[model samples]
Target: MEYRITDGIVEAIIESHGAELKSFKLLKNNEEFMWKADPKFWGRTSPVLFPIVGGLKDGKYIYHGITYEMGQHGIARDNEFKVISHEKNKIVFLFESNEETLKDYPFGFKLYMGYSIENSCLSIEYRVENISHEEMYFSIGAHPAFSTPTSENIEFSDYYLEFEKNETASRFPLEGKNISRNTIKFLENSKKIELEEDTFKDDALIFKNLNSKKISLKCKKNTRVVTMDYSEFEYIAFWNKVGAEFVCLEPWNGIADFVDASGRLEEKDGIIKLEGQEKYKAILKIEIQS
Candidate 1:
């Protein structure tokens, strides 16, 4: 099922399955700021990554000497979530660990995803509660694709991502499903990344060390812009299928396994170990100007 929240100025559509965001738009002009999920290009608009942000080494991880197999981004995105609340301008969806999840994750937990809008800024929250008696290790992240060039007169190349602060970050290029230890100089004391089809030719640009906590999608042809403040996230990435008209701003608390990584879960990169009954939260705020 799907639910909607509106603050008169804007509205968002969320669904129970995966707790994924289906749409976000301005009510006045009925203008959509999110990418339309087109199967030809990509089938997801906005999907939350949980338990793990990326892929595992050798398609599995070792936990306490036991091996478990998990695919990319974990199982939360494909699981069904329960609607916890749906008030005007605010909504929360809940996904608790189930018997099926334990087969791959081997832990008991609850994930809460909340979305709210006040004026033009949208607040997104991800909360994870460790229900297992033992210390639980996990990771979480966000993947939201926004439409670029909001007008027909402009092309995708006319848009760029402007960071809040100048950055000297290199991208860890993907080696198949895992991260390659090798790095490529992407931004060196620069703040803007020109959006083009070649930007994603080697897959998503993943950055672990960044000086900026926020970025804005802008174009030279118009005033329409989408800004995202991902202060709580440690790693950030930008990705899109080649030839697609949208771009994804991914904020991740953890990254995929490195090429020579140990298969242990606790040793995984950016793994979060939560004490029993403890809760962890990550938030991202988005402001849209159109």
Candidate 2:
């Protein structure tokens, strides 16, 4: 089912499947800030990446000496969630491990996702609880696609990403579906990155240890903006389909497997290890400007 929330300034739609955000719009002009999920370019608007952020080596991983096959971004986005709570401006959805999930992921877990709207900003919160006797290993991230060039006259190249602070970071390049060991300098000392069609010719740009927790998508031809604040995440990724009209701003607590990975789930880069009865939480905030 779909739930609607509004704070008089902005309106949003939260869906039960994957507990995903389906739409975000400005009330003043009824202009949509979220992507329309154009299948010609990309079919998903916003998906929750859990258990794994990216792809594993050969779409398989080893856990306790046993091999398990799982697809990219895990099973969360494809599974249905139960509504835990609901209000006019807030909603929460819950997902728990089942026999189906245990086939690929042996550990039992409870995942809670909440969406709340306040004024012009939307806050998304994720909570994971380990419910098994053994230690649980996993990763979680957000994939939110926002429309570029809020104005019709502005071209894709006219938009740019402005970081809250100057960054001297490295971009972890991807080889096929796995992450490569080599990295190249990304931002240098600049605070802004101009967008272009060829910018993602390689793949998504993954960054670690960035100086800023907030970034804004802006256009030179218009005053509208989309800002994302991810203070709790350890890594951030930027991606888009070539020639697509939208960009995904991802904030992750874990990442994909390395090309030379040991096949062990716990050994994957950025994997979170949680003991029995332990819980972890993270938040991502997005604000739309008109």
| Tens digit per residue, CA lDDT, model 1, 143-200 | 9999874356788889999999999888899999899988998898999999886889
In candidate 1, the residue pairs with backbone N, CA or C atoms under 3 Å apart (3 or more residues apart, or in different chains) clash, namely none
For residues 1-290, could you state the per-residue lDDT of candidate 2 as single tens digits? 88898898999998898888989999999989888889999999899999999999999999889999999999999999999998888888999999999999999999999999997789999999999878999999999998884346778899899999999888999999889989988888988988998899998999997999999988888878999999999998999898888889999998988899988888899999999999999989999987
Runs in model 1 lying further than 4 Å from the true structure: 149-152
Model 1 Cα RMSD, 1 decimal: 1.2
Runs with alpha carbons beyond 4 Å of true place in candidate 2: 149-152
Deviation (Å) of 61 in candidate 2: 0.8
